[model samples]
Target: EIDKKSDIEFTLKVSYLEIYNEEILDLLCPSREKASQINIREDPKEGIKIVGLTEKTVVVALDTVSCLEQGNNCRTVASTAMNS
Candidate 1:
């Protein structure tokens, strides 16, 4: 039934973020220079919201997968005692 509901279209927005060391970074940022510290706040009408985040509208599964891969590549990695 769900699979046959392809005609039911809707907007799908996707965003990626990495939260580490008490900081939130936008993984979808084009460059480090353009990357700004993301913030979370409560809006009276809209409820909790992310202040500044990169969001991309994806039409297909491949598009979403691409976004995920891009963000994953840009993810911050640090050598820890266990990981190193």
Candidate 2:
């Protein structure tokens, strides 16, 4: 389980069954300057595109699965029983 805490007086939670369901990728910063400095690279082959940016917001194209895979033991599977 991933837990996040902030002192900025707001709450945020992001979850995905395939990507970051089991781990936290990176902490969301209060400022874009801080978030920009973070070396969270997705894929060079896919190409990184700067969608938007600001003092409070920064958006970029990234592969969620790549980021999540960096965390420990992120593999998961579902099972079904034939007998009841």
Candidate 3:
């Protein structure tokens, strides 16, 4: 939790993606269509940027977990499946 008296408010944003078959795939996108290919380019000030990536804002720690679960569900199925 943030301090009530703090003057600055922080907002955390995260992006989830995977590199498979020599291509970058965004796992957080809601559409079931083909995963968009992302480009990694170095910017003058920002350094590296992944073009066309979806960034989700996490309000809290619990929200981060929810985003992870959503991205996990979007992962491609493999020969192995684990449930716990």
Tell me, by TM-score, which candidate is best.
1
My TM-score estimates for the predictions, one after another, are 0.77, 0.18, 0.75
Instruction: List candidate 2 stretches off by more than 4 Å.
Output: 1-14, 17-59, 68-75, 82-84
lDDT of each: 0.87, 0.35, 0.80
Give the alpha carbon lDDT tens digit for every residue of 8-37 in model 1: 867898999898787788899887655565
Model 2 Cα lDDT, one tens digit per residue, 1-84: 134654445433233222234432233233335434333345679775233221222133244443344322433344547432
> What clash count does candidate 1 reach?
0
lDDT of 3 by residue, 1-84 (tens): 457768887779988887766778788888645355467899999998998788899988998999899889887665644532
* Candidate 2: pairs in clash: none
Candidate 2 lDDT for residue 3: 42
Better of 2 and 3 by lDDT: 3
**Model 1: residues >4 Å from true position, as ranges?**
1-9, 44-46
| Clash count per candidate | 0, 0, 0
The candidate with the higher TM-score, 2 or 3, is: 3
C-alpha lDDT of candidate 2 relative to the true structure: 0.35
